[model samples]
Target chain A: MQFNANTKMAEVIHVNYLLLPILNRFDIQLGFGDKTISEICAEQKINVDFFLEIINSFHDYNYFPQDRLQSFPLDLIIEYILKSHYYYINIKVPLIETTIITLSTSSDKLQNKYVQLIVKFFQEYKEELINHITDEEIRVYPYMLSVDKALRSGNIGKELVEKVKKNPIRIIESEHTNIEDKLFDLKNIIIKYLPPATNYSLSNTLLIELFRLEQDLNDHARIEDKVLVPKVEMLENQILQKL
Target chain B: MNLKKTIICVKSPIIYRGIAYCIHSIQPGIELEHYNNIDKLLKDDNHEDKLFILDINLLPDPAFYFLERMFVNFQDLTLIALSERFLSDKLAVYFRGSILITDSEEIVKNKLKNIIDTGKEINRTNRKNSAISEREQEVLRLVAFGFTNKQISDQLYISTHTVITHRKNISSKLGIKTIAGLTVYAIINGIISPDEML
Candidate 1:
């Protein structure tokens, strides 16, 4: 999807009905009095470029404009990104979970077992996903912000920054990838091996929702892994160069 | 299946405490024991199928005397040697009788979960007949046949790092370390015929 500031929200959603949730998330209303996305975002006091970056990223992951991201205020970016995390944790997850329980309990005997397994798999997946973002929110991001603060203040020692660099972050990357893996497992179970023919609409709805989530979730992590990590490393280097 | 208890034998209370903390982090609420003097603890305690973790660097008794003595007494127990240094010849022989050769603390921290998992596997196997995953068993079979880590990775179509991981799992699951020891295990398990090796 070639998303731009002037593109109408109606036109975008026409192609992908799943994008409604993401648009509604930022209070970017559908009937924007016929306003363009950029105009509507500006009206809401949202950072238009940041919104574009996120939406475009949500649109196409491989098209992350790393160059445009440098001028983006990280504080604003992080806040907006953190809100996306809350949207998953507080809203989407519980909604999906309740849907699973409601749908699963209504299944017949043979199907109930499979439905139970699906619910179990999703519960475990939800836990891991929460932990993944929670670690980033509670630990990694705060550390990066501190590094940013230290750099901006011109006082954090080279030794400390070096120490942070020396410490391996592959653990986080592995865990972050683990979250993706659990979803893939769920997807395989749903698409390939799901029990035959009961509540087809409910089952299809769950799969579609999962398909949408997988994209949004991976994009979220891509932003964190690709954009934030490298940007912080750049800040560290800039500080080193100054010294 | 009964949950297995883990015992750590080391001289320094400080280091023992550190190892205990790391183990606890990997697995919470398992039975764990620490003793400067293993013989005394063995005599006093009645744990069947206990898994022992020993740091040979700190073994006050000559490695052979203590390791052999403990093996004789705790026939059902599995042993894992934890240390930073390579084993001395005598110590190496003793390690061959045990279940694992744990690397330094840093490597241990990274591989700790796999270590504990393997120990539990060995413990539950009713002494020396633990079932490894098919892939791990294949790695073990190749390793026993004297392939290098890289060669095994190539043969298995997996990365050298994955081969190393499987090797670690193999060591933890079966206390035999040397190529000779592993060959004996492989033959006993019918992983490969003696005629095939010859």
Candidate 2:
């Protein structure tokens, strides 16, 4: 179901618990009692329209209104993007690593070996993921924000313009595919090759976390590719035309 | 008919042990004659209706011609390609089925069961014109179970390129492109066990 400003915030969570982490991105805590999304946004001083669009898109993948999202100030989108990156590096990555460590310690010898291989695979993936995230943080996101700033101020700095021409967002776009492919391979290696674990709950938890991270990352990429990149591209083009 | 005799022509003791263990696990009473060389395997005269698991890597140069000649001489021989890696398509065409040294005991048993149940030669022409050949079905099952292209190729004695081609054909024929979608189809079609999902 497509949630709107009128939809009860609690009802949204009841329908899809996956939205819980996403809600946390906006600092929307669980104590929201009987508050409609509009009411909560007013209470929290969050943008009701932006909240509705983000939640609706997250709730239903097909519900993304790209034009509407892009129309919002790029700052709002980038803030969420930065928060997601923070979540991945600080929360999700550590959580998965600890889960692997826990499962490996508790599993039998056969499953332990599998978990060790998984650790190696995940370590490589983690390095690549962090590198990708660092590239975005250190380079791509800055370029995007600079472009947005230049477009808004109606004045592009000479150095910033040169940087824009040198580093297009397409490089980051291709890296997204590589990181995603590695994640997919990691999941399959565990699913297809691993011997069944004696500590089933721990193994299942690892699987669940991997799947959740994958889905969330894909959604995050969609925002970057479909909404963020195009908006930045438009800004870049406008600035280039002025030049 | 019960599988009365089998021959394994592999040099590596480890691979030989693995194949022997799987065979014994499946049919404990069956006879398995091991030969470390092609000449030794060829010298044996009783080849009718016998299962032969031969390692293509161990075979001398021009393995394809030798394999074809062996098949022609023993029309009833059931040849299963045993390889550490995928065999070239030219060499793979002679086998009734194939198994990898890296294959799980269950996978080895399944391939053996399939070949024994069908008891048919690898008719290349018929497979080429068919909607989805038996080999393609094997590829589909492995693909559904989340085996990568290289893994599927290694297990099936086909090259990675061949695996990709089969995957494309399978996707087109079944109208399913994603691995998850193909997996659901496999579960529905009984290509793999639902219990394996756990």
Candidate 3:
């Protein structure tokens, strides 16, 4: 049922309950080492929205230190990489590997070829993902957090704040852009996972999983853009006021 | 002309709070006058020869009526418009040719000295476009137009104490020691033309 725009928040929350359990399972599978991507989906029960939210929250939580007193701690940055980047790769790689295995065993040659193409795409996706996470943790998050602390304490001089504000995150976000371009290219190659003739069960399952993964990453980028950058900007202003 | 004591008029509580803060920060010597209505300001015996800070928003419709009255009654009084928003038509018709407008107290103190300096400039030909910082010109024009301290405060959306501080700065910069001195300086400087001077 379509809900009206003016629907109450409580009603929206109630509707969300239908998918909650599936989302909880995805979260648990992603959080724990219990199930591979293929195994998680083989169960045929998952909450797509909740799964996206978890991915988005992981990205946001990593961008800034949750402990206000820690003042943009280093550990938070590492944890972000561990959760959003490393964990994502771990789950996705096995799913692709299993899908490739399932495709190989299929009776139809067209279905086997489709799975082969997906496996190749996942291989390149994993490489790009690793580099993106490393660059953020090593360069971007540290500089941003440091600048935030300096601004809050009023120790950051006017000249420095002006300079940093002008540039903000120079290297990390640029790399992210490059990585996103590659992801887009990969997506185009997959072409919405359209299976050739003779493909049936494997084709449907692969399409479903790939669509879900694409959605999860898109959500991850959005939370970073909206919540993380604004938080950093606020911190920068507070620090500048002190100086 | 012996520089006479400066006087300030204001109207609002929020602006009065800001003015109090500014005064506490920068203590300038001047006499401050507070009034709730234009009637009280106009009825004052000391209206003539005093620098009046008026809140343009407080005046009734066809503001020219009040402007003309002040111009006719007090020949040497300087009027300034202290207001939140200075609409172009209102400014052009009522304040443009006569009064100055300002929004913030800090701008008033910082820019008043420049307005006074430019006013002292004998040849008006060399006057720069922003001869007075926008804020100082605002307070100066309001003072010239006959606004009370409280009225200026309410109109500018600042504190009455800020109006007082702006007035003190206006007096010191013009080297005017009294309200009469400020009025004469304002007239001589052409801040308010002879026709507009009250």
Candidate 1, residues A26-140, lDDT tens digits: the string is 8776775567778888889988888888777777657778868756866776886787888888988887788788778778875675576667667877887788788888977
Q: Candidate 1 docking: what grade?
A: incorrect
In candidate 2, which residue ranges exceed 4 Å CA deviation? A175-177, B1-198
Residue-by-residue lDDT tens digits, candidate 3, B77-149: 5445566554444243333222224435654543333333333322322223323444555567667667788
Q: Docking quality tier of candidate 3?
A: incorrect
TM-score of chain A of each: 0.87, 0.94, 0.56
- Give the clashing pairs for model 1: B98-B175, B99-B175
Cα lDDT tens digits, model 3, A1-243, are 433323332343355543332233344422323343334434544333323344334434343323332233433433443465554567755685576567667636644544454455566666767777677768677767677656546577666667566766533464463445444444443342233535456655665566556655665565466545656666656655555
lDDT of 2 at B107: 94
Q: What lDDT score goes with residue A101 in model 2?
A: 94
Off by over 4 Å in 3: A1-82, A105-115, A151-167, A178-199, A237-243, B1-198
Q: What TM-score quantifies how close candidate 3 is to the native fold?
A: 0.35
Q: Cα lDDT for residue A63, model 3?
A: 37
> Quick one: ranking by DockQ, best first?
2, 1, 3
C-alpha DockQ of every model: 0.02, 0.05, 0.00
Per-residue CA lDDT of model 2 for B109-180, tens digit only, reads 876765664455334433333345556767987886788899888777679999999999987776556565
Tell me the docking grade of candidate 2: incorrect
The Cα local distance difference test for each model comes to 0.65, 0.77, 0.50
- Between candidates 2 and 3, which one is better according to DockQ? 2
